[model samples]
Target: MPIFRPYDTPRDGAPVLAAGGVSRRRLPLNFSEEDLPLFEDALEAAIPQTRLLELEDVGVSPEGMLFKDWRILPESFSSPSIMEQFLDRRRSVLKFLAANYLLRRRRKFGRDCLWIVDDWSAGYFHWLADALSRLYVARDAAKDLVLLLPHRYRQLEFVQSSLKAFAVGSVEYAGAGEVYFCRKLFMPSHVAPSGNYNEEVVRGLREMLVGFYGREGAGSGAGERVYLSRGRAPKRKVSNEGELLDTLREFDFRVVHFEDHPFEEQVRIAAGARVLVSNHGAGLTNILFMNPGGRVLELRRRDERERNWFFNLASATGLEYFYQLCDPENPDEGPHTANLIVDPQLFRENIRLMLAG
Candidate 1:
């Protein structure tokens, strides 16, 4: 008869041990009893009722967040010393095996999972590969691993490339999945536009707003977001400010030329506006925090160097969105290289649709 293990279907059963026929040698390392309980608590929350075989101290930082290495230890290796020594060993092989074992266990237990790792980005993916290769296993079980990227696409490509290099079989990217690998899957409670502000951060913001804007304006707060802008007049090559001014005026918005302010103040300003507008860039990411029905008027480059990520965000939150494409022709270059001018009619229509919606 086949061994009936909980790991066969990731969705069912407990996380199992994956030793690959080799017995594990535990390492000796000390962890404060208080810290151990806290870690155990987190593990329980992440994987309820799942058995954990503490193997080693995975990594540590000044912030006091301990990344422990764990595997589903078989009954024979249940002795704490197996985990103790695993912590002390610095050899790459031991570390690699420890991670693989734990990951294999997680895969066997949880069918679909969301990993909210603190900013591992693509670097975390590389570690997954290393752990698998050391054990001579190079297959990903049929599951989706979505990474929550702290930075934009350009910044994380290196890690993306590394994952591609290590992938043995076919694995496809899921644009939107039930789970995602990210520092955060949704806006923090403090940033959430709701009456019940349970999070300490959100409560703090509420208190600050009460002090700053009083109850009326503060009561209208949705989510806090930082806005960035070039403070000075746009140089000729930097942006077409004249065209932007004309187009913005057509939409009944008075262009406010200002320097970068503190993050809190920026959010405060955005909260007061019916529509927030900006060039295609990072500053626009703040729109993610806006309340549903709020509008984002983006000025996209005519060359299409930038693409809107609002598709996912809009789908997630019912926010009204519009963009005015700006084509900057290089007068010094040939006619073929010249950019198309902004279509004023398109700009007006987008604004009208947003209001109508």
Candidate 2:
């Protein structure tokens, strides 16, 4: 009943402290069942990198935007050519290096303006995978690229309606100097929920949500079973939610609540679901507007260990994920780990075996 292992020691002269996660645990020197596929291949998968690493000596000071292809925090890597990835999040990265050093000192946005300093800017799947990485890059690599964003993020109404499905722009602040990111690219950051999911960030968040709601038309007709009802968040409630919404309304589940609709109708009801069913929150990051052989399930809370970012965005958007941990009438009430308490006939037999398979 003891094993634990991790430090493969050689974090190339190791130094950078920490950012999080590393719950070392192990037990099975000679356990049975062929080591359960080496404990499910040492479960921790989230690898998704869609290449964007552009950096031509990025600098800009006054506290941030240094970038040598920023994305450092994997528990502060000790380096192995990962060259100590970095980020200075006291946030909005010093208001995007003081609005790119006052728009390159009043030369008014030289090199086609691309100053998008983000740190989950009010998350909705972390600003749809960090502000559209300049509208999915490769527009002749970076010609006349304009993705400013900083006008105090226009009071974040889903960041001003997701910046009208960009080709977007902003930045109305001034106060600092020494800017030179002549089109620096890194795109692909967020790491909170089992590593990080990438299929180019679920195909640039499903091509900016079908270029702002259009994949098979928006709204009305959206209902192939949804049930994402998280209700006024008192800590991810579902404590037998009226017997799990009467057993998910006997199967026609369309219980909705991506914050009471309107983020383009919550991507047209998660692209007219084909079975979503939620209990984890952030409205299951709209399952990246589902549709790619869909079916999510996900409901965990018993023993809650948080963040697997929508089960690794349901395996990078191929969505057929399923989970169900619930069990808490009061397992020590008050630590608030998504305070759930559902067991209504085992959460309706795991939602009737996930709607009968």
Candidate 3:
């Protein structure tokens, strides 16, 4: 059976885990734990259990919350407070929802389903945290389950390969239909808008990932040092990539860019590392494959100060994660897409400490 930890559905039981609470108040309410934001919505759809009702119209529902229920999920630590800032411009959620929004398209599904919507289909980071774990939630009923996605996901090499490993065949995309329905629809809670990565999300996803990582084999490339490079970003180039690479090579670090290779190849390479080091980029998500007790040193952009995504991933996978803030290309300027510069001495010292551990 597919695994989703606290939100996992069972083979012979109610689809609705618990009846949710309701609210008429808006944001910033002093909410107790029992009074969840998505509870009422979940209750509305879950009341008629064993029912598959289809409406004549199907687009963004009037609710305006595609996956809000996930925040209230038992296994999720995300709470109603998050709803306050989720639609904010700074939150990536706004862009993600806008990108996946169906303007003049519709589709249908044949079984119970779920979807985790995002634009970066090929991004390993998005896959590990949102896409892949959401699949585990829907996989329990594979015979009668359909996963919805944008057409772009079909084009991604990692997306296709990951689906095959789990024997997943039921999938769909958005476009061109007046009526669309499903037996059950689950949209995983990314809760990305909030910069925090709580324990539940970490442990739950990691549990599902362990099986997939099993193929890497024991003691594969033991004590290997891998540096994930970000020389390919369209705008955020690593200005000191050459110097960093030269320094890392001196320590026997093998350089690899996840974007350069197929998804499986990337995982295969990441699986063997004892020390994985790189600038803060999507490739570091591969740290999920490394054996526990492995180490990660992330070179973060001082100006941008990104969310604690990989650090949480490392925590979940039992890898030791370390990070150092590096100056941006133009320190005087305001925030924009930018590269990073790491002090060579500082990085080498950190590497030395990592190896000693």
**Where is model 3 more than 4 Å wrong at Cα?**
1-110, 118-123, 176-179, 187-223, 303-306, 332-336
Q: How would you encode candidate 1's per-residue C-alpha lDDT over 1-357 as one tens digit per residue?
A: 111111121223323322212111111012234333222321211111211122222221211112322222212122235434543454643454444443322211122322222222233222221221211121232123332222232244333432343323333232221111222111100111111111222223223332443222455543222222433533322243454455555556644433344434444555455566665544454444355566666655544421333322332334465555566555454322333355656655655665564
Ranking by TM-score: 3, 1, 2
Q: Which is the better candidate, 1 or 2, if ranked by TM-score?
A: 1
Candidate 2 C-alpha RMSD relative to the actual structure: 17.9
Per-candidate count of clashing residue pairs (backbone under 3 Å): 15, 4, 1
- Model 3 agreement with the true structure over 1-357: per-residue lDDT tens digits: 111112322234335321222212121112224433322322221111121212221232212223222221221223344433443333455343343354324344445555554443346566666556545444554445466665556676777776765655567754422224444565444433322233344344454445564434346564388888778776555688777766787788887767787766666677668888887766777787776788889777764433555655665567776766678887765434667888888888788878776
Candidate 2, residue 29: the lDDT equals 21
**Clash pairs (backbone) in predicted model 3:** 106-176
Query: Candidate 2 lDDT, tens digit per residue, 290-323?
Result: 8877777777665554445565566666667666
Residue range with the least summed lDDT across 10 consecutive positions in model 1: 187-196
Error of 2 at 300 (Å): 13
Better of 1 and 3 by lDDT: 3
Measured against the true structure, the TM-scores of the candidates, in listed sequence, are 0.37, 0.30, 0.66
